[model samples]
Target: MTAAPAFPPLVEAYLADLEHALAASEPRERAETLAAVREHAAESLALHGSDDAGARRVLDELGPVDAIAAASTPAAPAAAGAPAAPAATPAADVWLVVLAVASLALFVVPLVAAAAVIWAVVRLRAGVGNRRVQTLALAVGTVSLVGAAALYVSHVLAG
Candidate 1:
């Protein structure tokens, strides 16, 4: 009625530009393809409340016709022989693995082994390194250190 845009020249021009740009698409698909674009422009107009400047801004954001057409086209495939490289293990993890193995000497070197176990527990809780390997290291160190402590406690009680 009186509130409507009977002469929405900018909107008409934008749609015409979009149609020309979409010439590469199949004739049957052109209408369906532009459905989303039309909906967006309508929504923009509604939000801006019949303002022509808002309509112009939305059309500007859609950019030139050629660019829109190019964007809709599929990208070219990657060239052959481009395999990705494997990730390297962290230095801290390597040290943790070594210490976990050494922690088996709990009886001969309780303090160092106990320290190693504590380090492993901290690392394990913090989710450091590869899970399976860190878990194995933690298990080995924890059991040996606990055994060492149990033996020391029993020896003191027996005396």
Candidate 2:
């Protein structure tokens, strides 16, 4: 493979500073920012001439490393009354509700009810889902499982 083009010492120092500033960012974010900046520097240096003056001009356009790092970091929650992004519910939580309802409808089958109960318990332990929905699902699933067990016992006794 061809060797990478050598950057001037000034450009190298700026990149080092930027990398240090980004140390606390997510790995993917840090990598992406570094790569983008490196490419921009290369392109700018080629166009402006690869000298100390050109490196300074490119770094100036990119702004201070601290500023870039702060921008890369996630923002704090919006102040009260500011529009907030909606919390995303996981799909498994949605499925938990559906399975709970299905367990109620199919409570005659012990296996279906048992499956729903297991899923509800697992999700509850994982600390996910809407609070009310999780409670309802667990309650419904447990009741349905109990009913199915009772029905199974009765059938065995009778037959």
TM-score winner among the candidates? 2
Could you list the CA RMSD of all candidates, in the order they appear?
Answer: 11.9, 11.2
Clashing residue pairs found in predicted model 1: none
Scanning candidate 1 in windows of ten residues, the lowest lDDT window is: 71-80
TM-score of each: 0.41, 0.46
lDDT digits (tens) for residues 1-159 of candidate 1: 445343257887878888888776755566666776777777777777546787787777667767767666532335467774655766776777778677676455677567667777777788756666666667777777777788889989999
> For residue 8, what is the lDDT in candidate 1?
58
- Candidate 2 residue 128 Cα shift, in angstroms, is 3.3
Supply the TM-score for candidate 1: 0.41
Report, for every candidate in turn, its global Cα lDDT versus the true structure.
0.70, 0.84
| Segments of candidate 2 deviating more than 4 angstroms | 1-76, 82-86, 157-159
Model 2 lDDT tens row, 78-132 = 4777888877777877888888889889998767777777887777787767766
